[model samples]
Target: MNTSLKALAVFIALAGSAWAEDLQDLPDDTLLGEVVTATENGEEERLLDLMREVQARGLLMFPKPQTCTFSYPDTEFFGNEIFRGAVRWGFGTDLRELAMSQGFCGCIYDLGSLDAFTQERIGKPAQDATTSDFSVFRKYRRSDWSDVNERYQNFQLERCGS
Candidate 1:
């Protein structure tokens, strides 16, 4: 009986190690898929850990803004010129408000659409005073907006030399 129990413990330990090794061997896309699943399932802690791994691997991509007129409701938007100045000067809330009031564009680095999913789930930004408006804008899915933005950016680049 003691021998059987010892064998069972060894099996469990081996299985756990193997599982962890398999996870480490997974491709970036597979790991990212797990990140999305964790986010969708409201596993915030898991998502954070996975995001850290992704960042550590340098898998994150940040494309430059194709135009200075696009609006990013998910994040604070500032035009190219204003963004440069803000970087050189400061990134105060006052500058962001001024940029928004002037109808300038905002730049948010894409995280494989993870930010959109997070925005949809979180409902409101910390400083936003408005009530949830997602219900009113249910027709336009986040993925749809992403596709439209990608096409628009491509068109803009093709039409004008960027």
Candidate 2:
């Protein structure tokens, strides 16, 4: 091969290897944190890029197992619901469509219900809560996962059902 072709091939190979390495190094929490930060900053383009990267890498092949925690006090619990709603629904149609296509229906439904629940409880827009407020609420919540999926399912059925 000519010198130019040889250099181009080497560059492509290096870029491919670097991308594979980056995908291997990415963790679920890291990806989730980046998504949350993007939402907080209203970085729609960044969010779309991250979602595209996730799809291209096949990082989230299956919906992550849901973990329901019912130990949070009422305020913190409600705040978390609002935060999750904001984070999920905050994504633009393109991002939401990408995620749904990738099998994130359950997550979308659950967070949507959470957002609806907060609206009913507070009787106002829950999007007013800041990311900082969510961080503080998260700090106080129990890390232990509870088997409260049934309760949430019922709520979703009631609040998010067509």
Candidate 3:
């Protein structure tokens, strides 16, 4: 099979597996709704919390005894780290919007045409340090700044300001 076909197969497998997990333990309906909305907007695919919640809800929605139990890590994602990284590189406005929407203070780093989710742990700097630099995971490295900008423009032209 070609690479695209292989990727499709993997996607199918993961989606199926994800659909089979349960999450009745989490009870915050508001958070659940936010997650669902963000996902629908194509933003939270790489968010660990959102993904975990989705898996849980999928399991509850499916309710199969033969399903597998999955686990997620304990970490803070998107917000702080994306800010620091983007600021370090002096990214663009759209990229900054992406980070701010995810929790960055501003968008200084222009990822060009790349879309990424910064999903890493937050770290604390020493008192002597001048900046609060953090690390993030490119969980969804397939997206870039240009992709985001184009999408935003299309959204505005097609949906918002029309």
Q: Each candidate's lDDT (Cα)?
A: 0.43, 0.45, 0.39
**TM-scores, one per candidate:** 0.26, 0.23, 0.21
> Which regions of candidate 3 deviate over 4 angstroms?
1-143
Candidate 1 clashing pairs, residues 3+ apart or interchain: 77-106, 78-106
For model 1, the stretches where C-alpha displacement exceeds 4 angstroms are: 1-23, 61-162
Q: What is the C-alpha lDDT profile of model 3 across 67-113, one tens digit per residue?
A: 32211222342234554344223234345455434432212243232
lDDT string, candidate 1, 95-151, tens digits: 333333332223222212323433444454323312343322333342344454455
Query: How many backbone collisions does model 1 have?
Result: 2
Largest TM-score belongs to which candidate? 1
Reference-based TM-score, model 2: 0.23
| Per-residue alpha-carbon lDDT of candidate 2 for residues 1-162, written as tens digits (9 for 90 to 100) | 699997986676455445544432445556655656556657687677667666543346365656533222245434566665433333222233433344332344433443443354444344544455454334322232122333334434433231
Sort by lDDT, best first: 2, 1, 3
